[model samples]
Target: MQNLQAKGLSALVAISILFAGTGCQSNSASATPPESSKTLDTAPATAAPAELPIISERAPTPMGEESVRGAPADPSAGTALAQLETIAIKGRAPKTGYDRDVFGQGWKDLDRNGCDARNDILNRDLTNTVHKPGTHRCVVASGVLADPFTATTIHFVRGNATSTAVQIDHVVPLSDAWQKGAQQLVPEQREAFGNDPLNLLATDGPTNGAKSDGDAATWLPPNKSFRCEYVAIQTAVKAKYGLWMTQAEHDAIQRILTSSCPDQPVPTDEGGVAVPIAAEPAPVPETVQDTPTAPVPGPVSGPDVVYKNCTAVRSAGVAPIRVGDPGWDTKFDRDGDGVGCE
Candidate 1:
C-alpha cells in the first residue's frame, strides 16, 4: 500500500510537470498569462525533468480558495457559445480528448515540435517508442505498457501495440467536459483542452474508447475495481476547470464513492494525473469563426442505448425495439449508449 501510495504521489507530480509544461490555461491567444505559463517563468533555466512523480487520492479542493499556484477563477466566462455539442462516436472518449483539427488546423504542434502531446505521452508510457529524431513524433514502434490499472500492473508486450493498449485518456472526457462548462471556453482554451498535457494519461485504449463521451455518472472503467480512482480523477478535472456538473452527474459520482470509498476526497488537478481524497461535496472554451453547425442529432434509442441498469432494460425487451417503432421512443434507450442488451 505504501509503495502504491508513493507511486500515486510520484505520478501526480509527473502530471504536474506536464501541466507545468504548458502552464495551466493554455490559451492560444496571449491576452493574459495562463497558470501553466507562470510556472514557466519560475521553473529553473534548466531543461524540464525527464519524468516527474505521481499522486493518489484527490483532496476535494475547497471552493473559492486559492490553490498553491494561485489559479484564478474561470475567467471571461469563456467566449460566447452556440448550442452545446456532444460526440456521438463509437468506442470511448480518447484518453486525451485532443485533436488539433477540432480547435482548427494547427495548434497542437505549436513550436512545430513534431512530437505532439499524443506522441510525447506514448513515448513516456510505452516501453520502447521508436521516435523521429529531434521532434519525437514519427512513432515507428511502441514499448511495452507498464502501469497499474487497479491492483494489477498492466504489462503489455511490444507486439500488442494497439493504441487501445497505450491510449492517452483525458482524465475527463471532452463530451462530459463540454457539459461541465467546457462550452464556455474561448476558442483557444478549447483547443488546449484537446491537447494540454495536463488532462491526459496513458491508459487502456479499449476501456478509454468504451468510456466514450459519458461523464463519471454515466460510465466508468470496465474494470469495476477502479471506480473510486476514476471518479476521483473526474472530480479533479471538473474542479480544476471550475466546471459544474449536472445534479444527475454529481449524484452518479456520489453513488460511486459510496459504493467504493465513501470518504474519498475531491482530488487535485495540480497535474493531469488523478488522486484519491477523503470525501467532499460534489462539484473550457474554445472559439473559431462560425464553422457550420455540427448538426445536432436527436437523442439515441433502441439498440444504440447502453443502459446503466441492463437488467431494467432486459425486462422491457419482450416488446423489443424496432426502427421507427412509435413507442420505441421510450424504453431502455434513455441515455442512449446503444447497447441496451449489454
Candidate 2:
C-alpha cells in the first residue's frame, strides 16, 4: 500500500512541473510580438517624415530677374511698379524762363495727321463726335466726353462761349514738366512733350485750371476710380520724357500703384515725334482806308490786327479767319481746328 501511495505522489509532481514550463514559454512568446505587429505599433512615427515635402512645396519662388535688395519682387515683370523702381527721384527745378511759348505758340500738328494736337485729343477722347462741315473731320464740332477728372459726362460744343468747358489737360502739366526735367530738353523735344497725345486728356475746364502746374504730390483726379490710371499715365509720360519726380511725388505715385493697382502696366501709345520748330510767318501789309469808316465787310488782311473777341472780329468784317490767315490766333480759334472766327 505504501508503494502505490508513493507512485501516485510521483505522478502528481511530474504533472505540476509540466504545467510550470508551459506557463514560462507562453510569457516569453507574448513579450516579443511578431515583426508585422511591431511595425504597426510604430506606424505614427514613420508618418512624421512624409509631411516635410508638403511644407517645402508652399514656399514662394522668385520670378523673372532678381529685384532690388530688400524690395519685394514685382508681382509681374515689366509692370508699372517695376518701371517706377527705375525712375530717378530728385528735387524740382526752378520755373525761371518758363513760358507757354517756350513749349510752342499753341497746339501743333506734331503727329502730321492733318490735325492740330488740341483737335486730335478732342476727337480721340470725345464720344459720338460731330466734326465741322469743311474741316475733314479734323474739327470736333460737338461731342460727349466722359471726363476723367470730374467723373462726369460733359457735352462739348465748338464755340467761343462753350469750347472752354472741355479743355485739354496735360497729364504732366507744362509748368510741372518745366520744373522737373523739361528745361534741359531742346525746343523740338519740349514741343513734342507738350503735344504728345499720351499726356493729353479732355477734362473739365475748371478741373484743368485747378490742376494747373500741380504734380502727383500736389493734385490728383477727383475721380477715385480713375486715380490709378491717371497716375500710371503720369508715370509713363515722365519716364518717356526723361523727367524726374520729387520725393513726395514719387512716394505718392508708388503708394497709389502698390495699394490700388499692383499690376497696372505703364500706358503705351504713339508718342509725339520731335519736329523742327516752324518760324512765324511774315506779317502782311494792311491796306488802311484813309477815311476809317465802318470796317470793310471781308476777311482781314493784316497779321498785326488783334481782335478783342469774335464779335470784334465780326465788326472788323473778318467773321471767318481761317488758320494761317492774317489776324489769326488760338483765342479766336474756339473750335481749335486751326481756324479762327468761323
Candidate 3:
C-alpha cells in the first residue's frame, strides 16, 4: 500500500510539470506577434505629395516673339529693353478731364486694312475662325480662344451675351495712359495710342475687366507663365507712347522682367497705318469795308491794344489788366496770375 501511494505521488508531480511547461509556452506565444505584422505596425507612414499646376496650351510667347493676333515683334530685343530703361519714372498726374472722347471715337480703323480694328484683332487672334455671312468678314462668328491671362480655353460665339466673353484689351489702358503723360499728347497722337495693335491684346473679358486701368503695380495676370509676358507688353507700350511710370510701377515691372523675362522686347514700331486728317478749308478773306467807319473804340484800340510786350502795355497806361480785360494777353501774362503786369 505504501509503494502504490509513492507511485501515485510521482505521477501527480509529472502532471504538474507538464502543466507548468504548457503555461510557459502559451505566455511566449502571447508576447510575440508575427514578424510581418510587427513590421507593418511600426513602419512610418508616408503622405502623398501635392499636385502641381498643369501647364497650359496657351504658353506665353517669349519677349522677342509676337503674341496672338497680328501683334508685331519688337524691333530688336536689345533695343526693346533699352527703350524700357529710358522711360521716365514720375508720379502719376491727376485724371482730371479724362474722357473716352478725348482719345478719339473708340476703335477707329486707323490702320484701315479694309477691316475695323476689333475685327482685325479677332481675325488675327482667334483660331478655327468663322466669319459672319454677307458682312465681308467684318464680324467674327465663332472661334476658339486660348486666353493668356487665366490660361483658359474659351469657345466664343458672336452674340449680344456671348460677345462679351472675349474683349480687346488695351495692354496699357487709356485711363492709365491719360495719367502717364498722354494728357500732353495732341488729339491725333492720343488716337494712335488708343488703336495701336502693339498696345492691344485679345483676352478673357473678365480678366480684362478686372484689370481695368491698373498699372503693373496694381494688377498682373494670374497665370504664372503669362506674368512675364504681360509685364513685357506693358513696358513696351509705356515706352512706345512716351509715357512715364510711377516709382512703384517701375520697380514692379523691373522685378518681373529681370527675374523671369530678362530678354523682354519692346514694340517700338508703329503697327498701324497713319490716320487720315481732313485738310482744313482755305480761310475766306474778310470783305474789305469800302467806307472806313470812324474809330469808335474805347479803352483799347485795334493795333495799339495788341501789345507785344508788358513794357508796351505799361507804357500805354494799361499797367495791370485783369485776365478778362481787353489788353490782357497771354504773352504779357508770363505768370498767369490773372493780371497782365506783375
Q: Which candidate achieves the best lDDT against the true structure?
A: 2
Please list the C-alpha lDDT of all candidates, in the order they appear. 0.46, 0.71, 0.67
Candidate 1 local lDDT, 1-342, one digit each (tens): 999999999999999899877865465446566689877887678875677556322222222122222133233322111001111122222223332234333225332345455544554445443443453233424455544243334443223223334456776766556544555555555666666545666676556555655676567666676676566656655555556655556667777766667655443334232222314433223323222224333444555654343333333432223224323433433212221121
Query: Looking at candidate 2, what is the lDDT of residue 22?
Result: 96
Q: 178 in model 3: Cα distance from truth in Å?
A: 0.2
The candidate scoring highest on TM-score is 2
lDDT of 2 by residue, 1-342 (tens): 999999999999999999999998899889978889988886565435444332111111111111111134234435777778777787766565666557876688876767787877777677677877887677778888888888898998887557778888888988778877787777777888878888888888878767756788779999999988888888878888788887888999999999999888766554345434435422222222222123357766765877787667766765445556677777876445444543
Better of 1 and 3 by lDDT: 3
Error of 1 at 73 (Å): 21
User: How well is each residue in 85-148 modelled by candidate 3, as lDDT tens digits?
Assistant: 8898877666656665577664667766555666666665667777778766656778888888
- Tell me the alpha-carbon RMSD of every candidate: 27.7, 16.8, 19.0
TM-scores, one per candidate: 0.43, 0.60, 0.59
Summing lDDT over every window of 10 consecutive residues in candidate 1, give the lowest-scoring window. Answer: 79-88
Q: Cα deviation of 247 in candidate 2 (Å)? A: 0.2
